[model samples]
Target: MAAIQPPKAQYQQVAALLRERIHDGTYTADQPLPSEPQLSAELGVSRQTINRAMNLLRSEGLVRVRRGFGTFIRGVPQVTRDAKKRYAARNQGTGAGDVEIKALGLTPRTEYVEIGRVPAPAAVATVLSIETGAPVLVRRRHLFANDEPTQLADSYIPWDIAEGTELLNRNVGRGGSYTRLAELGHGPVRFTEEVTVRTATDDEASLLELDGGQPVIDITHIAWDAADRPVEVALHVMPGNLWRLRYDWDDPTADEYPTVDGEV
Candidate 1:
């Protein structure tokens, strides 16, 4: 005889039903979902059950809760960060973030958070091969897609490299920072990025418009010039549900393990 299956918990059932409704267009991106009380009444469940279901959806990033507004379905991610082409695109004058946003027919904007020389943070100093607390030019900005914030980017450059240059300005002009670095003979020819995922902090959740306890993607990027010296270090944070990271490269061991004729 076949084994019997256990019934789903009340919240799981509710969440599954709600998820189906969302997928079937009963809920949409342009409007908020019905209030919790209304959902409870319609589903003949307790308000607590409805609240639990909502929390599950929030964790999955299917919906977001606003302070004074009702929950709303989330749109698809607006950025695809491809490691292979990111540097190549930057060399052409725009960063991969802006290029991807524009490719999706969305507007991209950058709001400067800070632009000045300051003592480098401990981590940043280590990455830039500088003494702790050494002065460095820091450019911090918030990247937006349309009106929604997408990323917080903070870049650090050595004092000697950034001094007396437009890299210290609010607007670094057409090609952005990399072009300026090139002009200074420190153009980046290689890059390395370390990526991690973790729950968002209170400030990160607020800035990214994410529900509390939501996850986020953290990245630390280092750029090197032809001379093999680190030219810049940048830190990036983005909402986990609103970004996709892609990487592609040829296998380094391909030549060592060359395929023989009729190998199969």
Candidate 2:
């Protein structure tokens, strides 16, 4: 027999109604929400249950409460990021920065970009299969939407491959670094990304313009050429509250069981 599902709780029903109102503009940024007693009467629930729902909203950063005043809208993110679409676009030669933002009706810009030679940190070196403290070309940039900093990325390339090339330029040409690398016969054929999240440091907090107590996602990407040589290692940091990472599941096209190598 199939298991029976429990009905929605009183607090959950109240919270859903309030969320709908907020999304539909019934409640807006800085607008005060109805009092618990009023909501209780409106929803036919107890004041205590309504208060619980209000607290849930507060925890979600949707509302704030003032000691003598009432609850007010705090605001929510309008930006969304789909990881698969982004990477696939890059693989197909369309560079980053404009596509997604334009779809959301926001302006996108590369607010800052720089390239320089630097000693590879131990972490980056390990992922790139290079010597720790070895010289590498660092390409750093801050991605912005509507003039608000949203993402930061630092890409490390082997000095041998970057020296005396356009990769040294502040801007990485029309199709981005990957396209430039392809011309140099070191184009990336495969990439692996590892992700983790943690609290932002002071520098990260300032650069990303993150609010207090906001966390950031750290994504490390290791790119390999056709010969399986590690060509690039990039570190991306995104403010957790402003960006949503999306992943889509699909059935495997190749053999189901594969070993450490790509072979099945």
Q: How does each model score on lDDT? A: 0.87, 0.78
Model 2 ranges off by over 4 Å: 1-21, 26-80, 90-94, 248-264
Which residue pairs collide in model 1, if any? none
lDDT of 1 by residue, 137-238 (tens): 999989988778888999999999999999988878777788899999999888899999998899988888988888899999999999999999999998
Segments in model 1 whose C-alpha atoms lie over 4 Å from true places: 1-13, 75-78, 91-93, 258-264
For candidate 2, the lDDT comes to 0.78
Q: Residue by residue across 98-187, what tens digits does model 2's lDDT show?
A: 557666777777754768899999998888788899999998889887766768989899999998899998767777788888889999
lDDT of 2 at 36: 83
Candidate 2 lands at a TM-score of: 0.70
